[model samples]
Target chain A: MMNLSRRDTLRLGGVAIAALTIAPARARAETEALIKEFAGGKTPKNAGLTLDIPLAAENANAVPVTIRLDDRFSGARSCEEFLLVAERNPIPEACRFKFSPAMGMADVTTRIRLAESQTVVALARMSDGEILVRRVSVTVTVGGCNG
Target chain B: MLNRRTFIAAGAATVAAAPAIAAPVAVTSTTMLKPKGKKPRIVIAGGGWGGLSAARHLHAQGADAEVVVLERNPIFWSLPMSNKWLIDVLNTDYLLHDMIGPSRKYGYELVQTEVTGIERDKKIVRTSQGQIDYDFLIVAGGIRNGYDAWFGNDEKAIEFTRRAYPSGYTADAEHVAIKNKIHNFKGGTMVMTLPPPPHRCPPSPYERACVMAWYFKKNKIPAKIVILDPKPRIMPIGGGFKAAFDELYPDIIQHIPNAKVKEVDPFNKKIVTTAAEVKFDDAILMPPHQAADMVWRADLIGKTADGKPTTWAEIHPTMLHAKEDPNVYLVGDVMGAVSKQFGYYPKSAHVANYIGKIVAIYIAQRLKGQEVKTLLPDNLCYMMVSGEPKEAISVQFDYEIMPDGTISQKQIDIDIRSADLVEEDHKWAQRMYGDFLA
Candidate 1:
C-alpha cells in the first residue's frame, strides 16, 4: 500500500487549477490594467508605438530595451509626457519622461531595474489631452541589479 | 548426513539474500567513475587574463591530456591597455575579444556553460547542462565585487550596475558610468574610492582620478578629484603615481590615505568615511571583492580554518592542488599566494600568458608520463597614467621557489619608462588577444 501526503495532494490540485485558470486570468487582468493606465482610464486602439527587447539576453544584469513612439511632436497639440510601468515591481513606475513641443520626438534609452518577469507598459500623454499606449511582457530568467 | 544437508541449505538461503542487500552500494559505486587517462583532464574556468593564459600554455606544452576551457563570458578583456579607451585614446572594440576563437585555434574545447558545483570524490564538474568529469580543475574566474555587502541597499546602487556609455568599458557598466560622470562634469567635488590591496589593477582608481583631474585642469573647471584609499600608501606604483599626482594636478587633486568609505548617502551626495564626511557632486565607489561564487560553492580549493577561501591555490609552490588532488592547478588572482592581483607582482596579462605557457608544458609532460620539474614564472605589468596623451610605467619580476615549499619574488625591474612602451603596450594587447583568442 502507498500513501500520498496531504501537502502533495494539495500541490497537485493547485497545479491543475493554475494550468486551467490562473495563468489566463492573470494575463487578461494585466493586459486590461496596462491599457487602462496607458489611456488614462480609456482603452487605446492605435498601433503607433513599438517596443524592442532582446530575444535572449546573454547577461541578465543588463537587458537592453528600447521604446519608440511614431507620433510627431511638431505642433502645440503634440506629445507632452511618457511613462513606463512594469506589472511586477513593488513600484510599477520604472521610468517617466516628460517632453515639450520644442523638445522633439519621444526617443530615450536608459537601463531599467527589473524585479522579475513581468509586463512592461509605455504610455504617452499627448498635448491635445489624448493618451496613446502600448504594452509588452519580458521574461527575465535571472534578475540582475536588484539581486 | 541430514544435519549437514540442513546447514548447507541455510547457507545457500543467506547467500541468496546478500544480492538484495548490496544493491544500493552497487548503485552508488557505479555512479562515480574514477578519473581516467594518463594526463589529467584539466578544466580551466574563466578565460580572463589568468584562465586563458593557463589554457594556452597547457595546450602548447601538451601537458594536460585533455584541456577544457569553461568561460561564462564570450570575450576576454585586456585590463592594462584598457585605460586608453577611457579617454577616447582607444576604442572598446580593440580591448575585448572572444576567448573561444583562441581556444579553438589552439586545439582545445571551450565550453560556454555556467559551472554550478564540483564533486571532489567523483572528480566531476557540475553545470546547468550536465556533469563534466575532470581529473584536475583550475578556476581563474577572477574577482567578484561585493557591492551588496558594501552598500546597505540594492536600490541605491542601481546607478553603478551597468555601463553608462554604449561604447566605453565595453562590457563593464560601472566603467561606463564613471566615464559619463567625468565627461558631464561642470564643477564640484569628485570622490574615487579604492578598495584595500589584492584587487585587479592596483593603480587603476588613482589612474582614473589622474586622468579626470587632467581633464578638469585642461578645461579649467572648478573641481577637485579626491581619492580615498584604504591603504597607508597609494598602491603598486605608489611613489610614481604620487609624484605624478603632485606634479600634474597639484591643487586640483587630493590623495587621502587610510580613508575607507563606510557609507554612501546618495540623497545627500556624501560618503561617510572613517576619517571624515566626504561630500561630492559625483562618486565612483570601487567595492571590495572575493573569490567568485563557483569557487566557494565547489570545495575543490581548500579554505582557511576561518572558512575564507585562500587567495592563491593552496597547492605547493609548483601551483598544484593541495591534499590528494594531484591533477588540479591554481594560478593568477584566484591563488592566495600573491597579496596583490595582477600588475602588482607581475599579475599582468603578459605574466598570466607566461604562466599559461608553463602550465601547458607541465600538463603535456605529465600526460606523457614524464616527471615535470618545477618551473618559475615571470611577471610583467604595464601601468598607463593619464596626462596630455598617456604615459605608462612597467614592472617585471621572477618568482623563485625556496626550500620548505615557500615562494619569494625577485624584482627584475621597476618603474622603467619608455617612449615606445605605449607601442609595446598596444602590441602586447594585440598579441595577447590574438594568442588567447587564437
Candidate 2:
C-alpha cells in the first residue's frame, strides 16, 4: 500500500537539520572555490542558514531544495543576495536569489538537477557582511539494472 | 568444511537444481553463535548479499544489538559474477566465498539454518534448529522463481520444466546444468526467455544470451541463440546489449522482442509467446519472479494503505519497515511493494548489499534510542557483454521520493562495452566481496 500521507512528507522537512551539517567532501572544492570568489575573500560560516534537501533522491534531474534564513537575521539588516550550488553539476552555481531588508524571512525553494552524487550548498552575504552557509550531501544515482 | 572447489564441484556434479534444502543443523551445536546478553536480538533470515551486508554493518557501526545471521548455506556463491563462469571465462572459484569470514571479522553470530516461519506477535522466528526470539528481524530471503506463472498448478509440467530447463538464480546445480547445456550444445537454435521486469537482475537474460553467443562464436560452433524477451525492447540497458550483439556476434544471436509468453511446451522444447512462436534444440526458460515463499507465509506480502496487493512485503518507503509490523524490516530483493509503487531498484546483488547497510543503520539507531534518519540505497551494476576483449557495460541507479510518495528514479549508464569497465567491475566485485566476507 502507498503511504502518500502528506503529513509524513511535511514532517520530513525540518528533521534533516542535524544530518545535513556536512563538512564538505573533497569533490565540493570547486563549488566552494566558486563561493569563495563570490564572497571576495570573506569566509563563510554555518550560521542563520538552513539548506534543506533530501539526503537521497530518486530523481536527479529535479530534486526539491529549500533555503531558509533563521531569526539571527533582522529585517533591517538581512542578506541582500543568496547563491545556490550543486557541486557535481558541470555548472556548479545552480542559481542566485536577490533579496532586500523588506523581506523579514528570506527563504528560497526550488528544484535542481544533480550530475551525480555530491554536495549541495546555499550561500548568502548578510547586511552585516558575514557570509552565511548551509550545505548538505545529496546522493544522486543513475543507471542501475532495471527491476 | 566446504571450500570453493568443493562447492563448485557439488554444484557441477548435481545439476538437478536443488533449491534451499537446508542441511538440518542441531540446536545444541549452534550455541556458539547464540545470543548471550539482554541486548536487542536482531535475527536476519537468509544471509545472501543483503543479509550479510546488514550483519557486517551492524557490527561495524557497533549497533547495540545481538546480530544473528541465519543462512541456509554455509558458503556463498555470488550470482552477479557467474555469467562468465557459465561460459568458462572465469573459474567457479571466483564465485564462491566463505560466510564465516565476515561473521568472525564483524563479531556477529552466523547460524546456518532454514527459517520455517515467523511468529510476528511473539517476535520469534522458528527455524529447523529451534525457535529464536528477536527484538528486530530482517527478511532477505531473495526471490522465488514462480514456475506456476507459466504452468499454473500443473505440477507435472512445472516439475518437468524445472528439471530440464532451469534458471541459474538459486542452487549451484542449476548453474551447472545451464553451463553444461551451453558447452555441449549441438549446432542448432538455442532459446532464452525473459520474464516481465522487476525480476532478478534486469539485464541478465540479455547478457546470458550475449555470453552464450560469444562462446559459440569463439569455438566456431554452428549455433544461434534466440532471445525471447517480454518487454518491448529491453530498452535502456538492452540498447547496449542489442548493439553489442549486432556488432560482435551478429550470426550467433537473434533477439525477439515483445515476446510475452502465452504458452510453453517444455516437453516438446517449444514456447508460444505474444510476439512469435519458437521451437528450439536447446533453451533456458526462466520462471516468472515473486518474493520468496517465506514472505507470503508471514503475511508480510502487503496491500498498500489505499488497497493494492504487492508481490512482496510492503514497508515504510525509506525506513524499510513492514507496514503491519514496525519491528520487522524488509531488505534485499524483497522490497517489492515499494518497488511497485515507486520506481524499482534493480533486484540485483548490489542493491541488496547497499539496502542492507541502510536497514542496519536504521535499526541500530532505533536500538540506541536515537532519531533514525532514512537514507537512500544506490545500485551500481556491471554486465559482461563481450568475452574476447573482456568488455562490460555498467549502470547506476539513484532515487528521490516524489510528493505523492512515489519513489522517482534517475539512471545513468554506459551500455557500451569496454575492457576498462570490465577491470573496474572486477575491482568493484572484489571490494564488495571483501566487505561482505572479510
Instruction: State the iRMSD of every prediction, in order shown.
Output: 24.6, 8.9
lDDT of 1 by residue, B1-438 (tens): 878756665654332222223233432322322234465577786667777777776766656366777766655656666555666667878766766457666766676556677776777776643456886677676666656555656754534432221113223455565556777889988777775655555326666777778778877888888888776555444545777688777888899887877886665667787766798777666666555666666664556789965543455545444444666665555554432112123334555565566666666777788887666665455556555656766544444444434444433223334445566566656666666665
Query: What is every candidate's alpha-carbon RMSD to the true fold?
Result: 27.1, 15.5
Question: Which candidate should be chosen as best, given DockQ against the real structure?
Answer: 2
TM-score for chain A, candidates 1 onward in order: 0.64, 0.73
Among all windows of ten consecutive residues in candidate 2 chain A, which has the lowest summed lDDT?
A1-10
- Fraction of true interface contacts that also occur in model 2: 0.21
CA shift of B364, model 1, Å: 1.9
TM-score of each: 0.62, 0.70
Residue A116 lDDT in model 1?
56
**Superposed Cα deviation of residue B35, candidate 1 (Å):** 14
Model 1 alpha-carbon miss at residue B362, Å: 2.2
